[model samples]
Target chain A: MKKYKILANEIIEFIIEKNLKRGYKLPKVNEFQQTFGYGKSTVLQALTLLDQQGIIYKVQGSGVFVRRNPGDLKEYVALTENLGFYSNNQNVKTRVLKLEELRLPPKWAVEKGLPASPCYSVKRIRIKEDGPFVIEHSYYSQQSVPYLSREIVEGSIFSYIRQALGKDIRFSEKYMHVVKLTDEQAEFLQLEENDPALEIKEVFSLSDGQIFDVSRLVYNYKNSKFFSQSSDEILS
Target chain B: MKKYKILANEIIEFIIEKNLKRGYKLPKVNEFQQTFGYGKSTVLQALTLLDQQGIIYKVQGSGVFVRRNPGDLKEYVALTENLGFYSNNQNVKTRVLKLEELRLPPKWAVEKGLPASPCYSVKRIRIKEDGPFVIEHSYYSQQSVPYLSREIVEGSIFSYIRQALGKDIRFSEKYMHVVKLTDEQAEFLQLEENDPALEIKEVFSLSDGQIFDVSRLVYNYKNSKFFSQSSDEILS
Candidate 1:
């Protein structure tokens, strides 16, 4: 991640950690610079990025203030971010419905750039405060991932990939469409059959441009608002 | 618009005008340079931008090939773009449901940054080949737009704002969420009253960062797939 993005994420953590509310005044730019030990320009860039994301707003003469609380922001899925659900919803828990290793990858997985060799097929539901809002079916290339454990699936996979494996996802090809909920999906999401659900398909590649994971995420009909910028800059 | 974005839009138009198909071979870099009279770097940048948008793909040794037919792309709305619907679906037609000049704008308009003085309230349905798929309720700032006619509302408002008024939309703050269709919206979109509909709300600004337009668009549940890049780069 870039320095500005790192600083911006740190500031979000700070806001949430301090239980900041809307209109709550933040530290001065110089205070941020002194605390974070970043250059003045980098700190300003981080603030500007946050302002653009509607997280914090700057008044002409006044200092920066929170526009919305982080808890309120948990419902919005950042379209460009691959940080996983746990990053946004700290209270989110995972239920692994299916996890298996396969020698012959499925055709859909192969089509999404998964090697036709050993791979893992996983199905999981992300349980938030309300209920299970997201059902994620993922296929990971074993050659790239090497292994998978139930314990790891219960936590943030992206964070594990970045911190433990030292591999970072650089970019993704994503498509978002609406689909009527199936009986099975409805049962899982606690929605009526044929309810409209937002389905997002993503193919993730590592920084070295190697395809590693392909995931199809189906969100509950309600609480499925996603956010992305018209600019190509990554939100985080 | 930037030179590369302009070229990219032109390339998309050329692909559509020529009725290009998936796997179709596009002109070489030198051919584009000669035809468009742009520097090689600018031309390459445009192609790279398109490649990132999944419009075209390049093989190591082989030349560029169309990844998908432009006609097949109409269903995906570019989230980062403020170009309006007509740019994507040229065959789309508009039916004016309501067009009026208002002294005191609605609360929604004011909340979205509309001036309280005078503005234009526009309600229209966009009819595509399939059926009426989008209901647009827009509020335009009269101070910035000056004037609007039913004829302009029947066509592309954004294009008029750019070409006729000499003002271009620079950026927008957009939110996408799902809503249960109301009786009126369902009748206009030909969906059930409680069917899921995708709603997009955007506040558009001019090049000088002045807000000029605020629009709430409701799309038919069947054809509301929008596209956007996670990267900060604008996908033309």
Candidate 2:
């Protein structure tokens, strides 16, 4: 993880450890700089990223404060396209359900421009906030990362790809659909078969246009909504 | 509606009328200019908007083509934040459910920074492809729009406000949530009570920050998903 990310996590822990409530003021940059021993720029960057994630809101001229309703549906989805496979998907536990190396690509992978031959698959059931949250099936290009381990999958794969393999993710494209859960998925999620679910297919690529992974993610839909923006929003 | 929007709608109708399939190349720019009496710039802008809306896609070498499934889940949620009050909420028919002026405001209005003076309410049921698609309830600022009729609500109130009242819609703020249906909403949508649904609360403000409208929108959740972009996507 990046230094800023580590600091961000520490700040989150601090807030939780202190039981910070809405409108509770967080320490200013100088104070954070002294406390965390991070540079001024690192503290500022961490604060900005935290604000963007809706963890704390900056009230300009006044100070930064803990945002009310961190779990509010609206705040949760503010930049929804980037949800899942990130810090927000944090949980107490993750169970590895399947791992395999395959030569035949699924139809969706072929459609997403994944080349055939030499692919690794990873399936995971993530428990978020102590509840069944997401079931993900992901296929990776073996040529890119080349190796995987249960230990690495237990942590952030993106971090290992960046730190170990020295790869940087450029961007991701995703398509979402409302679907009925299959019997197996229902059992995993502890929901009834055919219950409504949100399905997302995402293609992650490196900055060099190397397709790294294609994933199918299914989220428990009853408590979730997505947030996204249009490029044409007029600024006032 | 703008001329580009009208032209875009005409193109949509053309595709549906002819049952254009995926990879079906649309007419070139000159052809659209000749057929629709549009200028080069107008044709280009309209095509760009259509492409952005996912009604059509541009191929680098071949030409512009009607996307395989313009009715796909992704397309429906493109630019979804400004739905109901705009032309993109296209359909076969719309049924006016209720319209009235009220002196008192809902608690949410004061919460949204709306004035407490008189306001008008409009309820509508929109049908797309011969099915109930959207139910919207809007509260208008009496000072901004003092007069409205069933006829105007039957069409786009934004049009009436723009063409008739000469008011321009600058931008809007929307909050989305997955909510269950109330009895009245269930009856209006003809769905079972407590069924999962997507709900949105929107505040439409003028460029000068005067809020002209507030809306609560509900969508039948069985087949719908939202599509949006993140402003921070690191373009490679």
Model 2 ranges with Cα > 4 A deviation: A1-75, A78-85, A88-92, A105-117, A209-211, A231-236, B1-75, B79-89, B105-108, B111-117, B179-184, B222-225, B231-236
**Model-by-model DockQ, in order:** 0.30, 0.17
What local lDDT does model 1 show for residue A183? 98
How well docked is model 1, in DockQ terms? 0.30
Judged by lDDT, which candidate is best? 1
lDDT of 1 by residue, A10-53 (tens): 99888888889756889999999999889999999999778655
Worst window of 10 by summed lDDT in candidate 1 chain B: B227-236
For residue A71, give model 2's deviation from the true position in Å.
10
Instruction: Give the clashing residue pairs of candidate 2, or none.
Output: none
